[model samples]
Every structure is written in C-alpha cells, then in structure tokens.
Target: MAKNKLEISYEIDFELVAINASVKEYKLAWMLNKSLAWNLVKRENIELDFTGNKALLISNYLYETEYQTFRLIRNRAVDGEEQFNAFIIPELKNFDYFIMLENESVGFDLNAFISKIKEIPFVQFAVLMDAAALKSKDNLIF
Candidate 1:
C-alpha cells in the first residue's frame, strides 16, 4: 500500500531577544539560521529588529510529508497576528533591518523545532507569533 502524502504549508513567527541586547542583524540572523537549520524548519523568511534590548525574529517555515499530520495541525494554531501587524508589517514595508534567509529543512517536528530554537544560548526569549497549515490539491487524484 502507498502511504498518503500531504503538502503542509505553515509559518512560525517568533521574537528572539539576544543575550547581549546589542547584536547586529547579520549576527542575529546567523544565530537564528543555524538554530532553524538544526530543527529542520525551512527558513522561508526572517526579519530582525535590534532597536531595543529584545530583538524580534519572524520566520516562516514549510515542508512536505506523509508521516506527520497531527503535528502539523497543532502547529497551525499558534497565534501572533496582533504582534505581526504592530511590529512586523511596518518593518517589512520599510525594509530597514529585515533580512531574507535561505529556506532548507531535514525533518518534521513542529513543536520540537520551536523548543529547540528557544534553547539557543544567545536567545533570551522566543515566542510563537502565528502558525497555519494549508493542504495542496495539485497532486490529488480523483
């Protein structure tokens, strides 16, 4: 029997406060990119703000799989829209300190990935902004 395959679309918006509080965008991006890489969450997009003691990081991640359905559904429910509108939108339009990173992945574990990202030594606080899942129908056979 063939296993069922699903294309899962999801985004994880988070704020990562640097331990030093004065870290540069590139440095912060590097730290986050490495952490995301470890967790297998593709870094679809990344934005960094260093204006204050707690810098913000918004990252979008996606993956295609057949073995992880429950995890995907659960991850799609993390909320942070208000924060995105208030903080992310302005920076996105301004393009002031935002940096877009390469997207890559290895495995599927949404919750574990978030937890791993939070474990990074330099990251003071990491909060989930928002997450949602969408199933692709292009490959569906009737």
Candidate 2:
C-alpha cells in the first residue's frame, strides 16, 4: 500500500512602514483592514502588526518642540477637549511607529498593495523587507 502526500506553498512578504506614534495602532489597523484597497488583494490572507520603537537613531533628529506639540494635540483629543482630527504629519519627524504585514497568498500583488499603504497619512516611509520570494511549507521526501 502507498500513501499520497500533499504540500501547500505560499509567497510570504513583509511590508514595513513608519507611522506617527500619535496615531493609535487600532485606528491604523482598522483603516488598513477595512479599506477597499487592502480588501482587493485578498483580505483574509494577510496579517498586520504594529509596533513602536523609541530607540531608533532617527528620533534624535526630531526637534523637542515638535514632539511636545504632538503630545499636546494627542492629549487634548484623548481627553475630549478638542474635536480636531489627528493628522499624521511625518514632517514632524516622528517615525517610531512600525507596521509589519505578512502576506500568505501566492497571487497577491505586493507592489500594488504597498503603494496603496503608502497613501495613508503619517506613513513616513514604506519599504518591502526582503523582497526575495519566501516559501513556507513542510518538506516531504519521497
């Protein structure tokens, strides 16, 4: 008797973007998850993670006044003292926020998806980490 083995493969990629720390992670995630732009590329096959890093050397380049202004506006919004929309201005020099995207579908157009992501406000930089094709699957020797 002989048994048949099956293998499944996917093209996984990571998209890195620097977002403003003042922008809530959930809000950005929600925007990405709900946007038609993201959905067109197969919504169920992607995963997103947001992280913050205060130690990056780039942080040193930001002026003290900019950081203070950001905090002030963010605090006011959080405290319900202001009804203004929090705009993510990368020029303020805050790029501590990081967004990592894991794409699990082989047919997904990464370049197109990334371009759309960059359109979101406050995205200082958008880059594709390890552009090489990566395949994830179990090895089977016959």
Candidate 3:
C-alpha cells in the first residue's frame, strides 16, 4: 500500500538552531533549514511559518518536496516585529494549520497569537508546534 502523506506546518520563529538541532551549534539559521527539511520528509504538503526567517510571507506550490518544499514561507526575523500582525494574519487567511514550535518567543505575545490564530477562518490547528510530537515521535526532534 502507498504511504499516506499528511500536511504538516510549523511556526519556527527565532530558535532555528535550537529547534532544528539535536545538538545545537553556531549558524542557527542554516541549522534550522537543515533541521526543518530533515523533520518534514515524511509529509507531502508542508507549510512553514517562516515568520522566523525574514524571507517574506508568501505561499508557493513546491513540486519538489525533497530539495525544495514549502507552501507558506515567511520569516519573523529581518521582517520586523511591527509587521508581525500583518504577516501572521495573512498565513491564516487561507489555511488552517497547527503552529508548531518547541516554545514561544520571549517578546512575542504568544497568547495573543494563539487567540488570533484560532479565530482565523483558515486556521484549524494553533498549537505549541512540536511539543507533543517530541514526546511521542523521536528523541532527536525535541
């Protein structure tokens, strides 16, 4: 039988290195990219809440799930915190996804985000990201 693919999404804000690393080092951004890809290979449609990377808030269909995979890509860094409301609002405009992460950002109003995310018509799952997965899935993802 064919393996069914699930759509997985995450909110990887500032802790790219720590979030992505089994053992964290320098080059947090780079480590995050590597770690994210490594973690999501089992899925098909992957939406990344890049509000952590400062890339931009945009969605694209990635045919190549191996080397290039992303649906919603936005970065919280470099993008300025002021624009956070705009960025996050748009992510919820079209899709309902679980906001995945190890923990919440310090300055961020996590409670506000949670309330807003849940209110979004498209957001079906707003959660602590990988909090549950790590406890049950693997030792490395935590």
Candidate 4:
C-alpha cells in the first residue's frame, strides 16, 4: 500500500509596505486616515500562537474600498512572552509596522502609495517589502 500526501499553498498577492515610525499604532492609523483621506478603523487584534504556548496579539486596523483592502498591523508582538522572537516578521524587526495592500484593480501605483505614507509627519520612512521573499511569510496569512 502507498500513502498519500497533501500540501497547501497560499498566494502572495498583496503589496507590503514596511513603515519605520516612533508613534503608537492608533496614532499612526489616525494620521494615515487623515493624511490619505482613508477611513481606517480599529479591528480585532490578530492572535498568533507560537510554540511553547506563547501567543502574540498584534493590533490591526483596516480600510476597504471597492477595489482594494488595506490592513495596518503592528510589527512588535503584543502581550507575548517571547522576547527574542517577538516580531510578526522577524526578518524585518527594525520596522515598526506594516501596511498590507490587497489591490484587486489595475492602475494602482505602489510607489506613489509609499510616498504618501512617507509624507506622514510621524513616519520616519516607508519602503516596499516583497512578501514572497520573506522567510516568515506564513505568519502574515491573516
């Protein structure tokens, strides 16, 4: 008899932006909303359970349009016991937060969007991140 195997893969179809800022999550969201004319609202925290029963609750804010969905997530792990391995994207630990953009429509300029994020007074810098190249990309499923 032969055994069967199964594998599942998730598509990395979203645009990721790493933001380096010294402000709180709510304040950043509020600034982005005001500056970009977006309606980002606080949503449920993203709970990620790791090994050794450690769970990380990351703050999440969301905004949606007819052709796109945007999610703002904190990089640091909140309310988690894992000190060394705390970041949601461990490879990009220096970043303060991430903006995940799911663009369903064409003509979306990611660079232009990044420029807008950089215009925020509190934001030190913003850069495009390649989700497909991240080693810990699985953690971004939410």
- Relative to the true structure, how large is the alpha-carbon lDDT of every model? 0.34, 0.34, 0.31, 0.89
Question: What is the C-alpha lDDT profile of model 1 across 1-84, one tens digit per residue?
Answer: 999998654343322211221344345545655765422244434344344543334444433234321111111112354233
Model 1 bad stretches (over 4 Å): 1-22, 38-86, 89-107, 131-142
User: Which candidate do you rate higher for TM-score, 3 or 4?
Assistant: 4
Write the number of the candidate with greater TM-score, choosing between 2 and 4: 4
Off by over 4 Å in 2: 1-22, 36-103, 131-142
Query: What are the RMSD figures for all models against the true structure?
Result: 15.0, 17.1, 16.7, 2.5
* Alpha-carbon lDDT of model 1: 0.34
Candidate 3 deviant stretches above 4 angstroms? 1-97, 102-104, 129-134, 137-142
Backbone clashes in candidate 3 total: 14
How close is every model to the real structure, measured as TM-score? Answer: 0.31, 0.35, 0.26, 0.89
Per-residue lDDT over 2-29 for candidate 3, one digit per residue giving the tens place of the 0 to 100 score: 9999876553332111111122112322
What are the clash counts of all predictions, listed in order?
1, 0, 14, 0
TM-score of 1: 0.31
User: lDDT tens string, model 2, 34-86?
Assistant: 55223212122111111342111111111022112110111111212322322
Lowest-scoring 10 consecutive residues by lDDT in candidate 2? Answer: 54-63
